[model samples]
Target: MKSKWPEKLRKGLHAPADALGNLFVESFHYLALFGIGAITAYAAVATFIEMLEKGGISVDDILLLFIYLELGAMVGIYFKTNHMPIRFLLYVAITALTRLLIGDVSHHKAPDVGLLYVCGGILLLAFAILVVRFASYRYPSTRVIDANGKDMDDGKV
Candidate 1:
């Protein structure tokens, strides 16, 4: 019979390296997320201050604030659940495009095909968000667990 000791010995030696590597990488990753969240919050505050100075807020300003909110929420969710919901990203992109379209079209009275293109892009992004949600519902991640650390097999959340 083949000796099982060698395999056990190898695994024991490799475990520390795997664990340390994960710790190193995740530490920096979370640090980066914190930095991004901080910068986003700062920028959002600056934008709000600018709007206050002007004594009025435009639709574009509101949309810009919405973008910042989504970004901040994305970072917060990551810290809370260790998972980033991609729908937040799609929503940000769609909001950005809408802001761009509104700003561009409102400034000039002339009609252009660019409006159509931007609208199409927004529609495509909406469709992508639906697809992501559908896939998440259909084939969910297996990391769902209950209070006792056992996998919950009831249904997708």
Candidate 2:
């Protein structure tokens, strides 16, 4: 006689260890997401305070603001989609590092060779990320289709 429970459900019920492991993994993921959001919020406030203190805003400062906005948007997207796009985070980091280097250049009297090298490395990484983002946009992993599996050419998907 077949049991009333579905096979998949029955299997899961039989493996309490697997279920606990999955739960722990999911809990950790959420905890980390919250931690990142908290840190980003603090950074955004700090950046705004510094901008106010400087009493002058430049293109690079504006870009730093954009980076903060992007970080918030990333968190929002994660909440909405239950997935975080590493690409978005990479873009934010690139903008942030660039802004940091620009600000350092503007405020410091002496040239720091170490910082210049670090900035160069950040620029290279940003270029790589931009290339990857362009390639992904040009060739998506999956095509969106309608209910009947017809490709939706209107870009709605």
Candidate 3:
């Protein structure tokens, strides 16, 4: 005759605890995404307005805007698809490096080994992106989205 009290007690306590933990996590996730999206949007608009006031748009400003756009897109995709694509971040990084290289060359006007390093870094990042794309294409992952738009990655009923 085994006592069923311990099993019942454990189940009674664990279910609500797990549900509360998930609730907190979901709340933080949405709040963080909203804050990031709002800040990125604000920065992009301020940059655009500043460029308008200056009466000219430089390559650097355009690149900055592109970076902000990518950030916002990443956040949006994460919210909708629940998956963030690494390619967007890579694109942002490459664009930022190009902007830096351009700004440096325009100001220095001299050949520098640092420029070679920047170019090498850009090439490496490009290769990494290529690898990621190839792998993703070759081994596509399947996501099961229910009517509620949540990912069903786990095999839980």
Best prediction by lDDT: 1
Candidate 2 residue runs with Cα over 4 Å from true position = 1-14, 50-63, 109-123, 143-157
Model 1 residue 99 lDDT?
Answer: 96
* Candidate topping TM-score: 3
lDDT per residue for candidate 2 within 1-157, as digits (tens), equals 9876798887877799888999999999889889888888889889888989999878786987789789888988998888677778778877877777877778776667868786887878788888878988998767568998778876645
Q: How high is the lDDT of residue 132 in model 2? A: 79
Ranking of candidates on lDDT, top first: 1, 3, 2
Per-residue alpha-carbon lDDT of candidate 3 for residues 25-121, written as tens digits (9 for 90 to 100): 9999999999999999999999999999999988888889989999999999999988889998998899899989988988777968999999998
Ranking by TM-score: 3, 1, 2
lDDT of each: 0.94, 0.82, 0.93
Model 2 residue 57 lDDT?
71
Cα error, candidate 1, residue 90 (Å): 0.6
Task: Report the C-alpha displacement of residue 94, candidate 1, in angstroms.
Answer: 0.7
| TM-scores for every candidate against the unseen true structure | 0.80, 0.58, 0.89
Tell me the deviation in Å of residue 34 in model 3.
Answer: 0.4
* Number of backbone clashes in candidate 3: 0
Give the CA lDDT, 0 to 100, for residue 123 in model 2: 79
lDDT (Cα, tens digit) per residue for candidate 1, span 1-157: 9999999999998999899999999999989999999999999999999999999989999999999999999999999998889999999999999999999988877768988999999999999999999999999887678887776776643
Distance from true location, Cα of 26 in model 3, Å: 0.6
